[model samples]
Target: MNWPAEAAAGCSCAAAVAASFGAPAFRLLSAGLALLLAVAVIPVCAVAVRAENWRANVYNEGLPSHLVAVDKNRQTFLFFEKKSPLKLKYSFPCVTGQLAGDKQELNDLRTPEGIYFVEYKIASGLDFREYGGIAYTLNYPNPVDRLRGKTGHGIWIHSKGFGLVPTRGCVAIGLKEIDMVGPRLTPGTAVVLAERLDESKVPQPDNGTARELRRLMHAWSNAWAARSRKMFDYYDPDSYSKATESFAAFRQNKERLFKSLAFIKIYNREIHALEGPGYWVTWAEQFYTASNLSTEGVRRLYWQRGQDKKFRIVGMEWTPRDVGMRADFQKGRLVAAALPPPATDASAEAPLPPRLDMPEAPGETAASGIPAVPAAVAQAEKLLAVSNPLVPRRAPAPPPAEINWGGRPGMETDREETPPAAKMPSAPETPPVLPEPAPPATPQAPEAPEESMAPEALSLTPETRAALEQAVQGWNTAFAARSLADMAALYDRERYNRLPGVPRGQSYNSVQRDLERRFRAPWLTLISRAPSLELQGTLAVSRCEQLVVAPDGAEQGVRTLWWQREADGNFRIVGSQFKPEELGLAAHYLEDVSNAVSADLEAWRKAWEGGRLDDYMSFYAPDAVQQGRWGAKNIRRQKESLWARTRPTLVQLSGLRLLMDKRGIRADMNQVYADSTGHSDRGTKTLMLRFDGRNWRIQREDWVAQTPQPVGGSPAAPHQNTQRAMP
Candidate 1:
């Protein structure tokens, strides 16, 4: 109980005194510290857990294993697993064609939507850098597309480095993503490309039509084997008439071959059917053998349900195994064989040696004992017989009658009088009993002309000419004002509008969108001269030289506008064409202006990258206007603030196009900006510059954003200075 006892007793007394006085303050401090720790650790813990169990989460979503789905509208490709707990394996951002919609024809510039399978993978020697690092070919125009008459080829899923640029009817992703996903894919991997794919929705195949088509195909093959006329009956008589005057003619042609050959065999394989909007299509590989002659090819048949509720063949196309065979048949071998029967069987029998005058099939050598027919006879047969016997022959219609208006009877009318007007004029009041004409008067001296004659009749009246000039001036003013409403007011509202680069008639909404996009630039100027006005009654053509200046660049061209006089007596632009001046001093001047503007752009970019705020600002004119998220305003303060806060690390420019005219220059380019903070953005930048004696200075600037969001799908907050960087 001596020293140890005394020490324990003293510590107990000290602890009791401290706890009584400091308990309340200490508890509060402890609680504050605990709250701070929870705030910091909870998010980290949640993230860790999510990272560890993401695959499990995916499985819970019930996605099939090894399936990929592309959402074109969302620009995402999702990979799924098909295990006990279906899960999304991976997801990647992707790009599609420049335009949206299901592809319908070649050069439609749209991505296709459907269930497709990877036909094959292309991993090497794909020197085409634009296609990214790897490619997977898809079987587009698969039986369904062929039946719909949709034509195009070479649609693939590929990469274009690390950018998200639109593709030419192909699916695109980053190079790194392609590298990771391409190797995991194999031939026949199912891929569904749709505008959008809801995770909760299930996909179902329409197999009822496919089954019926299979039965039809079997019957077709059996008919060929039996050389029966039932096969011809499957074809719609009206459709068959397009190729032959009647189904009887078609049967007659087939009958000759059926009887001449000892036996006919058709082997069908790889049959596929797809249901379309109003019809269905079937495609199959058909192996044919007539006596000793044998060949293989693809046959496509279009079918539609008739009033009798049965599918009948409506159209047919054949692609031979050998491409040259099509040329040979088109040149008359098939036509000659289908011609009407000769007067006697002797002439027909001579041509029937069971030998085809066709090129040797693949893998066949000259030593093969296959007989060859004479080429001269084949050519003669083609020249003498029509290729399609169904087409009726008829004489052309007679030329139309010609008669002049208000002229002596039987005078030939001009080309414009094809349509006759209502009602005929009564004979002129019996000539009002005119006095007898005197004998031929002596020829008077040729009278001097009142005015020098013009080479061509002047169709434009003074009033019409003045009105056209005024309209053009109004249009020029509206363009300079950068007012979309004012610009639209000059166009005819009732008719479709057309412009340069737009061949098809454009709707008012489309033209309005175009105008809005154009006016988004801060400044625009258009000047025109030497307008030639041609008036034809209510229609007029105004052609002139035009110079356009905008933020993107300047352009010098010849603009021809079609104007129609409205019922209200005002002229409105109905259509227009802009042809860029390609030769002479204008072209040379544009080249010089482009070079100068480009140099200025490079200088500006260098200054920004170098963090020389003063030098960068120097490129702008005193009155330079900038349109951005803050709206059109003076950019001096914004630039100063940006330079104070951050500095640029990298700058990339691409797709630079220049237009130059007498007014100034405009430069449009894609700009990628990276900052020291590791944040990056890509957008389109348009700079309008005017020549300030010694150099080109920016008079206006506009930016349109095209940046991808962060990986987790949340968009980055708008940067104070960069908000206006995108459209």
Candidate 2:
């Protein structure tokens, strides 16, 4: 046997083999050694396989399918791919905040350590040196960070343009590394940021912490669906305040919603738990339906162990987009139908599992401490309640504090994605059997809270008050100028139709016409004074004494206008009501007004028959359009000329009727007229009347001939027929 020179120089083992025995003995010993080495390696490989399986089954199964883990201390970026086994797919060097510890305020230069998600991507408008070419925006000040009173925004994961320099409260990696992982960092991708990566902290499949969190999640959801006041108790007041406008405001808004919604149903599925450095997060696909809306999304709740060692929800986040929860629920139902029934005899069954009646968190405890929630009771409470009684969304009343009814700038609370309006599906006649004890009765409008107990209504800022006054002044200016275009610009046309005293069918166009007639007088003067304003949410109410002076006389009254804060942050007149009693107009019932209108119609007929031109003209409004004539003046002139040409003999009216319409009181009647010229005609006449504070006058008059009626010579000429036919 020959040993290679390199093996002889490098292998003491080769020399030892040669020295230990002769060639034949060495061969036999080598065979025995090989067998022993193979036997040892087999067990080692088996242990490694079991370890991998343990990790997959215990940790990965309890986490989201894909995860982006960033270790600030280690300056490492990790990506767990979306695979059935959820294995780490990539690891790369990264850059974190320049300073140590979590971010606490704006410009803190410290990265936040918590669970967040990629909110969006910034593809353009990049400051190359600062943010690199491409960046994925992370929801920093995530609910947990917000609750902890940590501030700072614009946190992102981006490629590093200036080498691997530390970022200002952000995570940065090499351009090549980012490009490789960019596709997986889409919106709603879970991102776990920690000070250090510690395997010990990873959650196990059925650990105590995970089980307790599940129980808490179930209870919280049940309380919400039940509309129980206990739902609010799950939140840590001190921490929750930092995340919302105020605890009181939050409670008030939620209470209002609970009362307004006839029923609420919340179903959570595919729940997963993740343990961060100090907090634990449980997230799941949530399907929520209320009387007003239905939304499917992912919801995450951050829980922290308090000083008393009890876990409580510090904050929460919701991503409102369909997550197939409904479809999955249907599939689950089908699968459940195929399952075998449970054993009938209780004694024959195995021992029952331990209950999850854990202690509740502090600050929400009753005199009896934490309430017990045994497994049996929890199972009984899991069924959904199905009732959908829609509550009408009213136009917001004027409010002192600015409100975000939908989406307003600077709204404090983060709102889920809600459509402007959702069409509600009719509820099924029979709902699934509810939990043993029924939920609260059908929603009732809660009584207003006592003043002392009511949440403090935020007072409007001076700027808002000034803006409202400016809007009112602008409207007054437009009114005095008689500029219809400018007035239209200041009014929300849709809501403007609801103005008081404005007849139903009358639009802003008619209002403009009426104003034109009012301002027709030469040397007219208008004054508005003593304005008082009140606010309720986006709506503002302004009342002022208004005076109108004309050639004939002066009219004074109080004008009330409702203004709403539009999406553009400007105020516009929505509706207005005038108090005519201030101008000494008598208030009368509908019947009395109808009778008065009838009396006026009769007197007008008499005036025309007696050829009293002045009295006849008096019955028409100053700018009334009569018999296709433009004004009362033109109508009077035409009537006078026609009467002079042929004297009136007789006039009769029958089948008279009066009805109220959008315009005003409208009178319909059959009229018979004959002149000294020995001509007669019969027709149906219509008079559209308007009331000018004191009396009703004809705003419009029309006549339709009932064919030729030969009471005398060759029926009356078409052009000079009935009372209104004096063209």
Q: Say which candidate scores most in TM-score.
A: 2
- Candidate 2 clashes between residue pairs 3 or more apart in a chain or in different chains: 397-536, 398-535, 398-536, 398-537, 398-539, 399-535, 399-536, 399-537, 505-662
Off by over 4 Å in 1: 1-71, 74-94, 104-108, 113-127, 133-154, 173-207, 236-255, 269-272, 276-286, 295-302, 314-727
Residue-level lDDT tens digits of model 1 in 1-727: 0011110011122223323432223433432443444455664433110000000011121122356777776778877555444446678998776544567666545567665556545444465567764677776755445544567777889988546666667888887777666654644455667667655433233334454564565566667667777667677777544421234434554665566555554555545554433455565555444442333345666677778777877655442232123334333233111112223343211222222222233443234443233354344223212121111111111111111111101111111111111111111111121222233333322222244221122245567667777777677677767778888888976553532222355576777787798888765545555466664333566776665656465666787877766557777886767788621222223332444455566678778778787787789888776653222234666766675777677776543444332345445554667787777765556666676546778767755344233334332342333333321
State, as a TM-score between 0 and 1, how close model 1 is to the true structure: 0.29
What tens-digit string does per-residue lDDT give for candidate 2 at 1-727?
1111210011223223333442222433543543454455664333110000001112543467668888766678988754565667788998776544556677645577667787645554478877777787776766666665566677889986777776667889998887677766755677877766643333334445665565567667767777779888777777766653345545654676677665566676656777654567787777664444344556778788778777877767654443544344333220111111223332211112322112233442335442333333223222211111112222111101101111111112222122222111111122122222222233222222243222222235667667777787777776666666787788777656553323244466676677777656433435565467765433567777665544354455788877766567788876677764232111111223444565566678778888999988899989887545778888878888888788787777643334333334455554667788788775555566666645678878765444332333332232233223442
lDDT of each: 0.50, 0.55
**Which prediction has the highest lDDT against the true structure?**
2
Off by over 4 Å in 2: 1-61, 82-85, 198-206, 326-727
